[model samples]
Target: MALRLDRRRLVMGGGLGLAALALPGGAALAKTLLSASGFTHGVASGEPGPDSLLLWSRYVPAGEADETRLDAEIALDPDFRQVAARGVVRTGAYRDWTVKITLDGLEPGQTYWYRFIGPDGSRSQTGRARTLPVGRAERFRIGLFSCSNLPMGWFNAYAHAAARDDVDLWLHVGDYVYEYGIGSYAADDRIAERVVLPAHDHEMVALADYRLRFACYRADPDLQALHAAAPMVCVWDDHESTNDSWEGGAQNHQPATEGDWSTRRAAAVQAYLEWMPISEEPWKSYPIGDLATLYRTESRLIGRTRQADIGAAYREGTEAALTAFRDGVWQDASATMLGSTQEAWLARELRANARTTAWQVVGMGTIMGRTVMPGDALDLLRPDLSEGAVRSFANAARAGRIGLPMWMDRWDGYPAARSRFLKAAQAADADLVMLSGDSHNAWAFSLSEDGRPAGVEFAGQAVTSNGMEKQLGVAPSVAARSFVAANPEMAWAQPSGRGYMMIDITPERVGGEWIFMETVKARTSAVAGAHRMTVEKGRRRFTA
Candidate 1:
């Protein structure tokens, strides 16, 4: 059902500011100057379909009242000369004054402008959104983003992508907001003018804390511009809850100090749903004409098994025991990343979408390709490490003997799970294109199963999070060259760039362009580097 709206002209008294205060009897009683806090977070639209889109905004009442009725309108013109859809949504303190309404009955492949009006007649900034193209669409462009840590640097990637005219949809894989408190993760020297709000000074654990943290993140102008530019499809990763989170617990979350893991996880999910302009579904798939079907998967806090603890293994057992443990328990077949239900669903979708569409795109968190660090990679870094680092290097080299990957936090930890997904894609003969993030580095991998090409992956870099270069204490080019040389599956890598990925899909080919920002420490959207790669239709391999 469409939203009901009062057709009466809202009383306009003062311009812009809150003009009047209404009485209990639906009468204007007094006049008061109101701040523009009602639309402080701005408006966004998402979950686009051929005939529908969801609208969202955060409203703050002028007075002490906990609830307010706001009006929303969809129009064909910027001035709202031809109002297509009009409705009223009630927002209360329960949802932090956030209002989301799904507007349906719209034409396919059409653009629309929308805005929200507060009770006091304060209008929000106009936002533009469009529905998905129907039937044989010739082309579609998608902007991919992830790991937008506010304190680390400016959101130049968001700002850069918002200026593009070709993007039809934007996908944020995960880590939209960092849960770390002030002076954590990001160095103080690296933090420029951007500072988180006072209310979000501490790490987010409770519902209120998470809510405030999102509010702080959404307040950024660059991030807001990206939201208003195009329809967004978002998924939350570890930072939205806690770092390296699984189904039962997280790395950063301690049950004794942060309360129950379930409670904290629930709070984080709720806050993310309320803030993001997306549907309540944990995962969804979008069909772009006959060209592609985009599948958004949940890899964390859904069905993921406990990750391997190499640190614990080293501390508790001898090096020989650690090797045995890595060779045995670490490769447990029962361990899963997407669990059984989601895994089955993805397989079914791959087969179905492959038969119907030209491309099957898996939108997910973390890299899907195997990236085991070369055993000799440590040799190149020995000169850079301090005297105290010798022990750390020895431990890492010991683990490397048993063929452990660089980062257990990613798909490298779940080799069996990855194989299962790959096998399904291979069985379906799907031209799978995996779009991923969470490594904070740009990567392109030629993935295969059973010695046959199954798919290709384009993992985008972070918006502002520090990448391997920071941790390795090496130059950006050095890290990139080292990884690319070490792994045959990784065709290319940019281990230090902070930016987004631009994906263009056509019937004949799918192309990915890595747009590296000049410096995340500044506000400019200058380009530092860019690399493009393409895969031919049905080949499931990158073309030179």
Candidate 2:
């Protein structure tokens, strides 16, 4: 009998379906009896190309000791009546029981349903995937997301986007999973029903810990639905490994206790690559027909220099100290975000894509626009803040008064590098649209280089992590207005929200609509509000 499953049914049914087989005594025996030996997590697809796509699924066998062989099938129809491509792949404990296979020889711009079949007739949940277009294309929509801290709330943003048919792709810039352990970073604030996995109750340090963390995140029904709905292009931010990670070390990673940074970083990367539906390459580009070239770059682990310590500057407690820190440390001409090799590759790709496509979209972690905290906004800080927190905010505001941006972990910290990137875009005469995350708030920026308009950036709000409203005493509206007034490049700001962005790309324009959720505390996808901003074809700036 053929098992036909729809999206809703697959979503409601948490696990994969296993067909019943007749026993020797003529009784029907279901494979579900072996609860530990089936598709553990749902299926996912990513790394889409004109004729290829990468498919992923995790399968646990009853034996658990040996490798498990599985069959992968892709079809234009959900029922698999018209099978397009089929393959066999193996997964074992080595890769955390996760299997990823790249299926080629498919038509471009075609939607296909895929699933994995086990030896015992168990079938994974059906997932839909689409290939990138080859020639001229009219429009493309991407659901942008980041910073999904599970303990904070539900993934209503993912659910909202997954339920919609408009989004063709999912672009998660970074922080897909937070690395914090139980009782730290919003633990007390966690939703009542959401509990941390027993094995992942501590900060992730080893490969096994990272693997369990990903499994916990992937187990979310909403996240699985999002993955099943469309292919995702994802990258890891600092949280995937540790907070504020750079090339050599991280702000949160203490080598003395955490062992070698390199060892820990390797484990994190290995687990991420094995668990996520992405290719082995850390940075790559996806060409969306002749419409746009979506470039995903690595900004955190590869070439990023250590972030400047504004806390140290604040401790000095002097304008001269802040100025010295800004000029000497923050503005280091040689500091880089994407590093030298990736930067050069991106510059070359930007120029090349500009010649071929109408729009050049760069997807990377962290906000690229300049955001300086308004001095008056500091007074709006919540009265509950500790003395040290208050002092830090005060120092940040003072530094902002001296023309320094608030976040040293973002593009603002690497001014010279940002200038170089903008200059590259300017030289190519490209219609650039930069999509970013990691700030946890929404922002629109009109980028410029040497007083010339370079491009526009749409920084998406976090999926669930709290924003400025949680810390500021003032309302979100007041904070947003103050931020816009303080930063000239910032054309718009949403100081508080938990949601994602729907970015539409067309030949004439590219627009991003920030869709805010009603409440992440509940398991609902109700819409609270939305804000839209668009940049015309050649203007390289947001419209009035």
Candidate 3:
């Protein structure tokens, strides 16, 4: 193993060796203190459709094994005076103390207020969410978000979107909650090592730890506000569980130490489903009045195989085991990103949407493109920076690789699946607009099929979590120039900033704006700059 035992254990959130029988920190104490106030973890709604929407909340009780179900009300007024729909959803540890229910029979494009009430009449905060309209929609606003590492900074982007009066939906590209140990993802200086509240200091495995972690992040007002503001559509990237996660395991997960991958993944997924207001499905599509069909895809966890290490594979020498591994593995058409079932389902969704919709929208985890790092850009940045994690990043300016960064574990890795999807898009003749996040930077590209324009993609930057600039300390201008110069398909990119992307659609074009924050150190940072661009209809190219 390139990484030693201690490294593995450390990566897995301390060690099973040190895990005595009971979980660290008193769970009883946490349960006694947890309550529902001001929405407590705040209120959220998601999975908007022409007919229904899903809303979520969490209420920890005063005793062990004591479940709490709140009377959730969806209303036309924020004051709850005019109720449109109401139901009861009970919270349980099986899903980590989170409660979510979908309210159907809602009018399209209409706003609704929702709150959860406990048995004692203690109520959660009232929040608003919207449903997609049917036929001929002129415009819709989405709160674009990615990478919300609590310690990096505040989720001001989420908060910012919520406070605004315009947003109709919130789109989280991925990294909703990082799965790293308290200090592994963020340095102590930025947010102290022991800062993780409810004390999930080690790797989280139990339901309680995951619940506590979500509580810690949701406690942020900005995140709460955003959840309060609009309906959300979410997908997972690697960090939501671990860096470079596959269906079987993760780069950061140590089975011997952190325990089983399935156990950890379930905990993460359960925690996420509980905390966020998204629906039960891993992925789904929403129809916007025949104008666009938004497809929220599931990339992480479900069915991703481990990535091939080409460099190492090439070094396996002449043995048959190595030869078999090296020869057919790279072109293993069997290996996949989305499992066969999902791929088929997606094709059906895309084809079906294309028949009636003007735009087929996809919200995914990674950038969908083939971008080989420019050796020239590498030469410039490597010499200027000291040898550290910054240099480590520069090393990705690889001499020659099979594809892109796999785009920070992107579509490029799953070549066969990508080919199938592109073919599906072409067959459908759909005006495909893909929204992606994961690189922690903004990107707009024209997807091509064998060099012909096939679709368009706009990847949003991070909300508050660090990007290449934060990790590498590369000057904004240098990083921007390096990437733009190297990547011709990249219409516009900001390698140094943290922000969200706005997609405003009409019949003729899809206009995208990168709403960057001045700072994320506080809950209410103002906009420093707004980069506006658009993907014109028929052309399928990003024209800034």
Count of clashes in candidate 1: 0
Give one digit per residue, the lDDT tens place, for model 3 in 324-387: 5435655577777788888899999988888898899999888886565655444445345656
Better of 2 and 3 by lDDT: 2
Ranked by lDDT from best down, the candidates are 2, 1, 3
lDDT of 2 by residue, 1-544 (tens): 2211223432212333211111232122122322345787788999999998999998887764678799999999999999999999998888888899999999999999999999898899999999999899999999999999977888889888999987779999999998887557554567644443322236889997788667667867888899999999997899999999999999889888889999999999999999999998979999999999999889999899888777777877899998898879887889999999998999999989899999999998998998898978667789887787677677778989999998899999899999999999999989999999999999999998899899999999999988878788888888888888889899999888799999999999999999999988887889999999999999999995
CA lDDT of every candidate: 0.80, 0.85, 0.71
Models, CA RMSD each: 7.4, 5.9, 7.3
lDDT (Cα, tens digit) per residue for candidate 1, span 1-544: 0110111311222321111211232122111111234576778999999888899998877668878999999988899999888888998878878899988888888889999998888898888888898899899999999999877888899888988888888999999988876646435435634544322236788997788677657766678788888899887788989899999999999888889999999999888888999888877888888988988889999899888878876676477777777788778898898999999998988888889889999888888887866555555453656765655655665665566776677887887888899999998888899999999988999998888898899999999988766546556577678777767688888777889999999999999999999998867889998999999998888885
Query: Which segments of candidate 3 are over 4 A away from where they belong?
Result: 1-39, 61-65, 185-189, 192-194, 198-201, 311-330, 382-395, 400-408, 471-475
- By lDDT, the best candidate is 2
For candidate 2, report its TM-score.
Answer: 0.93
How far residue 61's Cα lies from its native spot in candidate 2, in Å, is 1.1
Question: lDDT (0-100) at residue 155 of candidate 1?
Answer: 88
RMSD in angstroms between candidate 1 and the native structure over all alpha carbons: 7.4
lDDT, model 1, position 415: 79
